[model samples]
Target: MQRLFGFMCLVLIATAVPASAQERLKVVASFSILGDFVRNVGGDRVSVTTLVGPEGDAHVYSPTPADAKKIADAKLIFINGLGFEGWLPRLVQSSGSKATVVTATTYITPLKLGSHADPHAWQTVVNAKTYINNIRVALSAAAPADAEVFKSNAEAYRAKLDALEGEIGQFIGQIPSHRRKLITNHEAFGYFAKEYGFEFIAPVGVSTEAEPSARDIAAIITQIKKAKIPAIFLENLSDPRLIKRIAAETGAKVGGTLYSDSLTDEKGDAPTYIDMVRHNIRTLRTALEGVTMRG
Candidate 1:
């Protein structure tokens, strides 16, 4: 096994083991990205159920009684925090789950959002490693019997993350610095912009649920015109009208769609978490490298 380092903590499973060998730690991850991280680090040691499944919109999701049952029975609950899952507290209470509720993004320095904390830390692979490690620690905490296993799994997964981060850096570097500015539908790419040294603008702010007022929209259009942002992009979970109107009003070409709130369809380019990151970098690079602002 690879050596383990520290900056953040890890949760090792030390509690009662399930009766069967196949028996695993019952874990409920608040959404797809966190759920995927838990799966990767937990490996066969845990059973993770995702509350927000593939292409599921977390911003507008309404949890049902069934989800409440899952949370109550889970050994641990993992949420992205940073106001990403505003609906979680009530669900946990309704479920009567005393299970440890851990923010998977707890280890990352979350970007100070416009009004709320940005929970999309997983966008940056470095921060993603934080989520991976925290999930390992959370699983370990809930089921301590698998402490060593969780550590081993976390170490291995983190190595993969290291490799992934390197690749993302190299891939992003391929795009000329001047061309790296991203204008997207929401503030979802803030961490990505920060980590990659790209300046990004969103007609909308952090939460997809918040609608931009006429003044806000006008200001965004004015900013777009002043900045000459070449391409305005659509996000997975937001309405297309705002981005489209901004692009039209600003005369910026529409960039391809970006995955902000959800993963791609199961059969599409970014179906899996790993693929999702790679696809995003690839998409951004292609669009940024090729696009030019009309004279």
Candidate 2:
């Protein structure tokens, strides 16, 4: 009888330990990029649900009933919030989620494209640091028990970001100023261009959902010819046809497909935020280097 009681107690303890270890903060990130940030900061302490998955465009994303259920179940919801997720407010309201909503882009100065704020602030490494910091604060506040863990994780991630920034600067510096121009499918690279000293021209506006008018395409073609821009890029989330059209008209080569607003799936080249930035810069370097060699 004594032996049987001891065995039962051991089994109960074993089951309880796993349950406690498995308990994690429930969080939802509006997109994959932000989801990466949360996972880095939250580490094993969070279970993150991303509404917009890998290679998915958030600008035109339609939330479903399943998405609403995820939102309702989340303890916290993170958004990019420089008007990036236009559909977020309605979705949150409809779901009636009591979860705390945190805007990861808060406190950073945003680059403006005319009257609209350019929401792709994370394109720049400096802005990305701010985003990580914001996410750290949100996670810390949500789970004070793991605040130290979040802080440590954020610091480590920031160091990586610092290194990435240095890499980008050094790489872009190698390209001659005249050869630093880029023509992409959309104006998603404004923040990147502003930070890296490149002139990025696009046919469509900030949002990918915005259709490029005939005049817009004509204007970009004219700019490409007048500026003698050497390389044009296709965005992963955009229609390559428009960029191909522009490239054909201007005789400018299509550099490569850039991961703009979303990350590639797990098995693809850009599986993480750091990988995405590195891949883009590497792609840019290769194409721009070719143009310089030709020139």
Candidate 3:
């Protein structure tokens, strides 16, 4: 009778314990956006550490000794490849990590800017789905026992992405074709522009670290005037002075800030990948919908 009672107690305790009670896989994401993706797919099965925090620029990020420690301790390291993190190679070497490096943009057809493959592929909702798929596969491979959990989370997240894409299209549809053109802080929105049928002009190149020369700024100012671009918006990761100066020179309104390259913290507008896309499109629509394009 005591044995039966003990068996019943053991079963109850086992049933009461949550699935998340299992040991979590430690993973490191190169940046905040990738960190968010890992969290959504990984759920409670993984602990993610982002090397670059929210609103932090990855283009010019300098890896620290602490980051090296994080890498050494991780079972997997996720990054946005296409030369996004130039500092990652050295960091990995220094850390002597055996962690599997997963490139989130593995299946993406990259957009070229000059001689560089644009690294801001996450700007478009479609490519963001690809990222989620890649992360899901990687996570499943790392933790086969939790494959079903990862799969379910990824499918649900992809559905949300599809809905987000529809929402973006609806917002863009409301804007006039000619008025769809705008000037951004940098060349980070090529994928977004291509996917949604918008024209984005920028003074600087793909990498935020690249500064626009006088000639470059002058060229952008000329283009904005000639094309009658509606607004110039500031990017969260970029210096606002350049965009502000362009807006001042061309009489284009300074549209609200756009979250590019990095996301804002939890209290800010864009805390997650989906939130980032929604915030950008809404900001664009609000700025361009009422403006009339003159030839």
Candidate 4:
């Protein structure tokens, strides 16, 4: 009887462990990039549900009822903030999620595009470090027990980012200043251009959903002709026809695809943040370095 009672007590003690301890922390990231950050920092402690998956544009994303359910179940929701997700507020209201909302781009100084703040600070690896730190802090707050693990992970990731920054600087230095200018579908690379000395002209503004007028295209073509810009690249999230039309009209070579707003799947060229940055700079260098600078 004593042996049976002792066995029953052991079973009861094993089952007494809290459910929170057994399950991972539930998090909802607004987009793919933010999702990547959370995954890196949160590591095994978190289970993230990204609203806008790989190659999906958050600027024009229409949140669904399923997305609401995800938010409803999340302990924390990470957003890029800075007017990045215009549709998020309504979705949050509809979902009625009591989750703590954390902005990943909290400390970084934002670059302004006319009246609006540019939300693509992640374009620069230096700013990416800031984002990682923010995620680390937020995760620590939410799960105080795992604070040390979060800090160690963040530090390791920041070291990798530092190395990437050095590599990009060396590569960009080799390209001549005159060959530094290029064009894209949208103004997503402002932070990148500012961080590294490059000139980027785009037909559409910061947001992908904005339609450019005929006059805007004409003006861009005129500028391209005047400057003798060598190449124009297509964004993964943008329509290729617009870039192709511009390239055809201006006689500028269609360089290659650039991953701006979102990342690609694991099978694709740019699955991770580091891969995306390397692919972009490699594409740019290949296009710009070989071309003869004109006018």
Candidate 5:
């Protein structure tokens, strides 16, 4: 009889506990980069939905009606801002999403993007750490229930980012300073160039939507020859013709592919944001050092 009573008590206690105990906070990130940051900071307590998929360009992204549905139920929405997602305001309004929208670049010292602002601040490893902290604070406010989880995850992930910064700085040190001048297909590497001791010259301006003028291309090509630039690179999202022309005309070696606007597929070299940075630096090193990069 006592055994039966104890069993009944256990059953009653189990029943009294709420089934919603493990319900996670739903988050929506503007693109793959922000999605990775949110995942690092949110950990297991937040469920994130990325509107921009891998290897996709966010500059020309157009949200679908289904995306509205995804945003409507989100507890928090994270975006890189700085005019990166010009379509976001409309999407948020159309979705009637009550979620708190926060910019990851809020605390970042805004970069000069020609006449505009640079939306790719996260390219710099140091800038990325700031974005992570901003995400931590935003997520904590949006879903205070997981404040501890967000804080803990932010600290752990920030350490990894710091390590990544050190690795990149160390790796890039191998290349001679004079060989550090870079000309790429797009202006995406400005922050990277500034942070890592290189000068990134792009034929095109801030937006990928625009085209580089013939005069601009000729000038860069001339500069490449004059400066004896060892290599020129094509961005993952950019048209290859420009860089190809520069390489062919200047006789400069075309460096390995650089991850600018997006990341690689799961089975490929750059599956995540961190992987993208490592892959880019390794590619640059191999090309500049005139050696093949090892896996």
Candidate 6:
């Protein structure tokens, strides 16, 4: 009888442990980059659902009924904020979700171009650290039981980001100041250019939906020729036609495709946040340096 009682107690304890471990917080990230940040911090404690998947454009993203349902079911919703997701407010209201909305870019000082604020804060490594910290706080609040786990994960990830920042600085340092000018498909890289001491000229405004007028195109072409800019880059989300046209007229090379608002699918080059930054810098360096070499 004593042996049987002991065996029954051990079985009950084993079952309870697994049940407790299986309870994960449901989180919805607005896009792919924010989704990656949440996953790194949340680890086993969260189940993340991204509205905008790999290579998907958020500027013009149309949230479906299924997306609304996902938001309604989630315990937490993370967003990039700063007008990046123009459709998010309506979607949240339509879903009538009670989920706690956390803006990852809340604390960073934004850079402005004319009257609009740049929403690509994650382009700079230091701002990315702030994002991780904000995520850690939000996750800890949502799941107090797993707060330490979130903190530990964030610390590890921040260390990796520190190393990445150093690597970017060193790499960009190799390019001479005069040769650091390039053009892209859109105004997404202002934060990156400001952080890394590069000049980025774009034909379109910050939002991908904003089309460049003939005057805008003509002025950019003139600038490229007058400045003797060597490289023009095509963004992953923008139409390549405009960039190609500019490149052809200016006698500039199409440097490479840059991952701006969204990441690539799993099998592609920039599947993760860190990988995306590294790939962009390497691509820029290779194209710009190649021009310098030939000249």
Q: Give each model's whole-structure lDDT.
A: 0.78, 0.87, 0.87, 0.86, 0.84, 0.87
- The Cα RMSD of model 5 versus the native structure comes to 3.8
Provide TM-scores for the models: 0.80, 0.86, 0.86, 0.85, 0.85, 0.86
Kindly report which residue stretches of model 2 are placed more than 4 angstroms away from their true locations once superposed: 1-20, 204-221, 234-251, 291-295
lDDT of 4: 0.86
Better of 3 and 4 by lDDT: 3
Per-residue alpha-carbon lDDT of model 5 for 128-229, expressed as tens digits?
998998999998887788799889999999888889988898789998988887667677888898888887776433234466567767777788888788
Preferred candidate (TM-score higher): 1 or 6: 6
TM-score of 4: 0.85
- Tell me the spans in candidate 6 whose CA falls farther than 4 Å from its real position: 1-21, 204-220, 235-251, 291-295
Q: Name the 10 consecutive residues with the lowest summed lDDT in model 4.
A: 203-212
Question: How many Å off is the CA of 35 in candidate 1?
Answer: 0.2
Clashing residue pairs in candidate 6, if any?
none
For candidate 2, the lDDT comes to: 0.87
lDDT (10s digit) by residue, model 6, range 155-274: 999999999989898779898988888877667888899888889886433334566666777777887898888887745325678778888899877787788888898899899999
The candidate that achieves the highest lDDT relative to the unseen native structure: 3
- Per-residue lDDT, model 3, residue 133, is 95
Q: Give the TM-score of candidate 2.
A: 0.86
The digit string of per-residue lDDT tens for model 3 on 8-54 reads 99999989988788579999999999999999999999999999999
Off by over 4 Å in 3: 1-16, 204-220, 234-251, 291-295
The candidate 6 region of ten consecutive residues with least summed lDDT is 203-212
Q: What is the lDDT of residue 112 in candidate 6?
A: 94
- In model 2, residue pairs whose N, Cα or C atoms come closer than 3 Å (at least 3 residues apart or on different chains), thus clashing, are none
